[model samples]
Target chain A: MKPIELTEAQVKSRRSRNIAIALICVGLVVMFYLITIVKLGPSILNRAL
Target chain B: MSVINDHDPVTEIYISSAMPGDFFALLKPRVMSLVVFTALVGMMAAPGEIDPVLGVIAILCIAIGAGASGALNMWYDADIDAVMSRTKSRPIPSGAISKSEALGFGLILSAFSVAILGLAVNWFAAGLLAFTIFFYAVIYSMWLKRATPQNIVIGGAAGAFPPMIGWAVVTGGVSLESVILFAIIFIWTPPHFWALALFKSDDYKLAEIPMLPIVAGEASTKKQILAYSILLAPLGVAPWLLGFASIAYGVIATVFGAAFLWFAWRVYKMDEADRKMLPAKKMFGFSILYLFVLYAALLVESLLPKLLNLIGIA
Candidate 1:
């Protein structure tokens, strides 16, 4: 098997993605409890109609 | 204290093996049943028709999302789980699954549940499912949980989402009826959970979980439980008065609400040393029965009209 290596930047990037995922989960509960809607935004068809 | 001794020769490592227990635990099966039952009520009682297939898909996605949340909770709380006798046997704590593995599994399932619901059902329902998982795993886990005694008060939003998700699946939008359903759970959660917190005060304190009873003491917790119960009883009857449900539901709600208040009153009046485990213990046991019966009544009342219509008997 080949030795696996990741540069410092790559490791940092991976960790950043993990943090984003964690934050997204946290945001969900906060949004619900606050009753805030981060609208997915209106669709093009809905705008046209 | 370790649920699994890491250095023991017989100690197991769950490298990649899958067990039935892991999957069941992930589904948060007990929680899922309540979610499914409430979701069914929301869908059935909604004004318009959702195709049976779409409705089924929506509920399935919600169930999967709930499980994903459960898995993430187990992954993060593994250390605390090991210390709490009540949670020590969980898959993560018991060494049947590694924390990293559980986290990855949860992330994958959350993504899958959301994506499938979006594609097969609608973006609205899918979005709700995605949010529910995030709320339970992240907000309830990393944010409010350790940070505040009001953890469950805010975290109960996770439990409240199923009705909205169910409603969105059918209506593809939000409405008053679903909001009422949401409110019922929101109010119910504090009392229901605080009752447990009442008896599990030491466990919470030891785990540093910041449960209200642990931080505030029994009398204050009992008072809070009663206050929430007061809010809950009226809120429980709101669905019927607001026209989301019928008199049948209203009557049942009134009866259960009265009994719930009585139980909470019993809890509030008892002194800590005057009884067995404490007033909180009795309140805790009755509260579970109260929620189950209340939701079951909601399901029955919502379904009765349709069941009657189907047979041409109404």
Candidate 2:
């Protein structure tokens, strides 16, 4: 099989998309943490034996 | 992913590399946005509480499942999409993505979304998501799309499932409220699609897809559009009458529902001499607004008291 090369536009598009996905994932993590805190209140920090 | 047979020279030559953007495009983000919005409304309208984190997860699963359906649709419709001008630039037709790649992406996402929803949320919602993906990809895309003029009417069920799934995520089962939401979209779809078919008949003809306008005569299509619109107008206000929504929503639904009927009526009476089918175009555009505004009103009705209480105003 011959090796396939990505065009310049394809490379740029892929890079930008990866960046966007990364950003969205980070945002979701932070939002999840905050929502847990809001929902659980003081219990979030209360790790009992 | 089912690999396309590499017998065609064009496929071998043009499809050198696919970007992540192409895979994303296969997901049809615009359609996914609408699904997310409606599903979020469904969750809000449900009587029970969903933990915010779980709510987010449910929404994510629904969105991913919607994207899976879109990708699979693109995979299956690639041949017709290549011929239709409106779809000619889609990722698969444009050679930005391969059919096999899209099929794989859709399948993986479908499994992941369903599995995660089942594990993290309720299996009922997960089951609905799985069925929705299958219904759209297999039932709508593979079977109904080319088989009959009433394709949109049946295929519309796939689009109508998100809200029901959302409600199930909160309530752990389907309810009258969710079914009403489902009915609103299911009934609204025929007129919405037929209006577009009026103007895009040539595209359908070229693609050989038997859309209502292409299969039925234009006058017949127009009559059916008007009939569905009449049914839709009354159904739009069913929630308010059934006490699922407030009176304010009833008034808004009634006014917008009347406007929707007016547009459909104009389409019905439009002259063939009016080649642009402006009435049909107007009806199509307004139909989208009609669904969006009605759902937004319902969402506001559901969320307002909670929001006010959160802010100490209620």
Best by TM-score: 2
Candidate 1 residue-wise lDDT at B207 = 88
- TM-score of every candidate's chain A: 0.53, 0.87
Pick out the ten consecutive residues of candidate 1 chain B with the lowest summed lDDT.
B9-18
Model 2, span B1-314: residue lDDT tens: 12344564434554335666677788999999999999999999999898787898889889999999999999999999999999999999998788888898899999988987887778999999999999999999999999999899999999999999999999999989899999999999999999999999999999999998878889999999999999999899999999999999999999999999999999999997888999999999999999999999999999999999999998
Q: State, as a TM-score between 0 and 1, how close model 2 is to the true structure.
A: 0.88
- Model 1 residue runs over 4 Å out of place are A1-49, B1-14
Give every prediction's interface RMSD: 13.9, 7.1
lDDT of 2: 0.90
DockQ per candidate, 2 decimals? 0.03, 0.20
DockQ of 1: 0.03
